[model samples]
Target chain A: MSRQNFEEQLDGLHRQLMSMGTLVEEAIHKAIKSLVERDRELAMEVMKNDQLINQMEHEIESGCFRTIALQQPVGGDLRRLGTMLKIVTDLERMGDHAVAIAKTTTRLMAEPYVKPLIDIPLMADHVKAMVRDSLNAYIAKDDQAAGRIAAQDDVVDKLYAKIFRDLIEVMSKQEHTINQGTHLLLVAQYLERIADHVTNICEWVIYMTSGQKTDLNK
Target chain B: MSRQNFEEQLDGLHRQLMSMGTLVEEAIHKAIKSLVERDRELAMEVMKNDQLINQMEHEIESGCFRTIALQQPVGGDLRRLGTMLKIVTDLERMGDHAVAIAKTTTRLMAEPYVKPLIDIPLMADHVKAMVRDSLNAYIAKDDQAAGRIAAQDDVVDKLYAKIFRDLIEVMSKQEHTINQGTHLLLVAQYLERIADHVTNICEWVIYMTSGQKTDLNK
Candidate 1:
């Protein structure tokens, strides 16, 4: 393939990745919305849309493989392709977590929440921003932006810890709260994990830009 | 690089992956042992050894990148290298889940038995088997074996559901068990996630051998 052709293909893959990122962000949003509002239909929609994200991941993956094989890209070009592969995997996993949140919503649909959902949405907002920023960093190859995004994980962690303690307290005091409380705990955990995936994306962006594998998750 | 040299390099990378897999398996064992026996030292060991797994992932990743760049491998060789890159990621994640389990163990070290740790260890046994078999499928390029291993995930899921219910029941009956119960629930969740990663490996193995993307997770 010509250099121009290869560059175009790479650009196309980036566009697909961005689209996939958008879908993932929406999934997270809708999953949390479904939970906070007790909207089963929205939850199901998030679950259904996860298939679209998975399909996009497979398509981008095939493109990456084809470009690498045909162009035989070296150094920076190869790193970019490899990073794209990893990014899609992260995005796909984020989509899966969103679906997990949706599933939790479904499981708790018939019953009232143990408590009014507050910190969980806050956790979701932080993760959504991390997701958006991580993708932007990937496109710009901004390692500094990636570093900043990773640092935001600390906030998500703190929110999760607070939510965990609060839920444990509620569940202990009320026998009926234990079931829904545990499910809520898992939801918070899923968001925290989504944040962790953002960090992985940040790490990959750093690797793609500077060729250094930094443990930004630490 | 000559063909023989490239083959040798690939073999070395595979050896490194297997060793990483071995470390992951051990980490899972020790993490559960720590939880079951309330062995804080064992939990600490699992946390420390995770660094070794992370280091191995980086080394094998670099080796795979170098081989792909130097050899410009096409067809099966390229697919094999790509699979190795992904396999290491899955293994590294399984290591992280083990570490999460170890962290849970550390948090609950002061607590007495909420129930015997029977089901959690049983879940771990299933996931550990999935890990070992997934790697064997990769080495043999056995898509059929991959399919079989993916089938095993059903067992893990059922086990997780059982554990979830059991823990919820115990916590509801005994309010004091709430904190430790939640942690044990997460421990079971970490094991379930490890099995999911094993399914991911199986999917990659099938893709490597047959050039098809399969959603074995469903």
Candidate 2:
């Protein structure tokens, strides 16, 4: 294959990856909305759509393999393919976390929320933004921007810590809230983990561009 | 390079991946032991060793890239490299979960036992076995064995649910145990996620062997 065809194929694969990312971001939003609004239907929708994300990821992954086998991609192109594969895995997992959160939302629909889910959504927003910026960093090959995106994970971490302490306090004082509070805690934990995955993507972005392995989480 | 040299290189990389799997299994075992025995030092040790796991994973990943670039592997060989890359990632995340569980163990050391921790350790054992068998299946290229290993994740999931319900009961009955009980819940969660990752490895094994995308988590 000619270099132009190879570049176009890579571009096509990347576009598919971005589509997977968009699906993941939607799942995250829909799952949180289900929790905050008590929408069981929306939660189920997120759960069902996870299969679509998985399908897209797998398709892109297979395409990647065929391309690599045929073209024997090397150097920058090789790193880009590897990075996309890694990001696809992370994105699929983030979709699963959304499904998990949505399932919890369905489970908790009967019980009144122990507290307003203000911080959880806030953390989700941060994670959603991070996911967007992480992809942008990869597309732009901007290591500095990737570093900045990874640093934003600390914000989500701090948000999760605060939610955890507050939930513990609520659970201790009101025994009835223990079940729902723990469920909420898991939701926040999922968002925190999603953000961490975005950080992981950014880390890969930096590595792909600079060939330097840096732990942005630390 | 000759076909023989390529096979040897693949063998060397596979060996490195198995070493990573061993370290991950040890981390999971030690983390749970620390929790079950209330051994703060062992928990700390697991946390400290996470860096080593991370280091090894990065090295293997870099090597994978270098080999791919230089050798330009094709066909089944290329998929094998991709599979190992995916497995290496899951193993590293499992190591992180162990560190998280160990950190929770240290945090809960001062508290009294909520229950006997019977199910949590059982779950850990199941997860450890999955990690072992998942690698074995991958090494053997036995997709059926891989499917069986993924099926065993249900055991861990059931154990997690039981632990969750029991912990919730204990927390509701006694206020003081709420904090420690929740910590225990997180530990169970860590183990459950570890099992899920083993399932991920099995899924990759199936993919590498059959080129079929399967969702073993369902």
- DockQ, per model, reads 0.87, 0.85
What TM-scores do the predictions have?
A: 0.99, 0.98
Evaluate model 1: give its lDDT. 0.93
Which stretches of model 2 miss by more than 4 angstroms? none
Interface RMSD of 1: 0.6
Can you write out model 2's per-residue Cα lDDT over A97-178, one digit (the tens) per residue? 9999999999998888866789999999999989888988888889999998898888999999999999999999999999
lDDT of 2 by residue, B14-77 (tens): 7888898899999999998998899999999998999999999898888888788878888677
Candidates' C-alpha lDDT: 0.93, 0.90
List candidate 1 segments past 4 Å from native.
none
Q: Work out how many backbone clashes candidate 2 has.
A: 0
lDDT of 1 by residue, A1-218 (tens): 89999999999999999999999999999999999999999999999999999999999999999999999999999999999988899999999999999999999988887668989999999999999999999999999999999999999999999999999888878889888999999999999999999999999999999999998876
Backbone clashes in model 1, listed as residue pairs? none
Q: Residue B62 deviation, candidate 2, in Å?
A: 2.0
